[model samples]
Target: MGYSVVKMKIGNSLEEDIRRIEAALEVVPSGKNLAVDANGRLDLETAIEYAKALEKYDLFWYEEAGDPLDFEIQAELAKHYKNPMATGENLFSMQDVRNLIRYGGMRKDIDYLQFDCALSYGLVEYLRTLKMLEEYGWSSRRCIPHGGHQMSLNIAAGLKLGGNESYPGIFEPFGGFADNIAVVDGYVGLPDIPGVGFETKAELMKVLRSVAE
Candidate 1:
């Protein structure tokens, strides 16, 4: 319902997912400070079993426990599910999201939407598609990004949308090339520092200049 303070995954077993879900339920007070995302990596049956296992807990959203572009599979998965399912990772275009909606998942079980700016049609293009998501009865703000983790983080910091994924390890390694944001405590906040807030390898640059010279 609202932004969750803690998020998690099943770690790789139905039994584990069930136990974790129960523990999270005990802590999060029905519907706050907890959002669980599976990252789209389970079989259909496994997903269903996991979903059935945690009927009591109010999940903020169930992320892609399956295929990213397989709208057809997603369509069937979202059907008649009690908890809301979400998708949109490793997705490359607005068409991916549109197809997720057009197929059946979006309206049926796709409760939340996620996107990675690097993989999708870029942030600008994805932003345009955000408007389209609403036409299908979805919210752009609900779009918890997958890789735009930093961009989404900044947006979430402003309380703009649901929330953003904090792939600290993954994004930080890549952030050496550009700007990046981090999630502190439970909210996303940009660090104020020199040179986009990160140090650079002058030696690396000098090597390039030397090669050219």
Candidate 2:
């Protein structure tokens, strides 16, 4: 209930999505961030139209309007829209992410990078990606990794990342923060237990302990 940012999924139907987004906006209250994710499913024209229609909402950020790897379309969308845009969840390598920056037409001023640690060959590569971003003048605050798990939580705290995504009550035993950790003012403290702290999440640790034994 202390959440300040809400991200919704879109790119299904233009009319329905617009209606749904408007409905979400009505209840989101002012001063709160309302973001949306299209999951890179829309075509160029539809993505453009949706972006145009979405502009009036003052969204916190619009995410993955078209194919995740299609930088050309993103560049085109950037020309017509000025709102903050986010992508890179599907990009699995640092090289592709670099290409997105060099040629994807992403504006650092208002765009976000969602390079997940697990999805991109784990934390080692994620660290490399962050370093790459720094060379290009991007800050670690611009990143919010794609996965919601204990490992990412530890990494977020250890590296001072912008944030980690979360899916509350989903993926039992593997997709949440540490057990008993409170979400204070939209934030939760990481566990101090060793090795990603799986032991702190009771249900998850039961399964993990079995694997270890």
Candidate 3:
């Protein structure tokens, strides 16, 4: 995969996670970035501990260290960790996102936001969220939607988002972008077709057609 950033899941155990991160760093080529996702599995103490322990690696971001809605945990972690952090994949509404921005202690300068339009509501709501971020002095470039699907890809391209997450060789027909567009040097071009470009993925298009029929 020509991705510049690779993300992995953590929060299993401090020691185990450290070992795994070291092992992953060994294989990932130089100049590439690695991100870790805990999926909101850690407590405040453990999340801070992990943040301290993993700070040397200079990870692209630590994701969802505690319950997604817990602003205190996130705020406390931010005081201890200076590196970039990411969350909001599970945040479904603009109001929830507003709360995160207000109380989550997320630094707009360094942190990234992963609000997936598909998971939240739709493009309309996502547009509103983007507007909200703008109002708060945040840039649209900090957003990288969570879903590894074409809908988010289209949104990323159209809205100039930071980047879109991708899952190659996973989730079968539904998790990737257009078949003809190849990722090169960690960047990929969007499909030329109109709409969200779902029809450009032959396998996914087949599945969609079957469901409709």
Q: Ranking by lDDT, best first?
A: 3, 2, 1
Please write out the lDDT profile of model 2 over residues 1-213, one tens digit for every residue: 567787899987989998998888888874137889999888889988988898888898889999988899988999877888999989978798999999888888778888877789888888888889889988888888887888887887788888888877878788988888877766888776678877788998789788889
Tens-place lDDT per residue, model 3, 117-212, is: 788788888889999999999999999999898888888988999998998988878888889788987798888778888889999888999999
Off by over 4 Å in 3: 30-32
Residue-wise lDDT of candidate 1 within 20-114, one digit each (tens)? 77777787767445667777777777777766665556676777777676676677776646776667766667776677778846653337776
Best of the two (1, 3) by lDDT: 3
Using lDDT as the measure, the top candidate is 3
- Which residue pairs show collisions in model 1? 4-34, 5-33, 40-64, 40-66
Indicate whether candidate 2 or candidate 3 has the larger lDDT.
3
The TM-score values for the models, in the order shown, are: 0.70, 0.94, 0.96
Runs in model 2 deviating more than 4 A are none
Question: Which candidate, 1 or 2, has the higher lDDT?
Answer: 2
The whole-model lDDT of each prediction reads 0.61, 0.84, 0.91
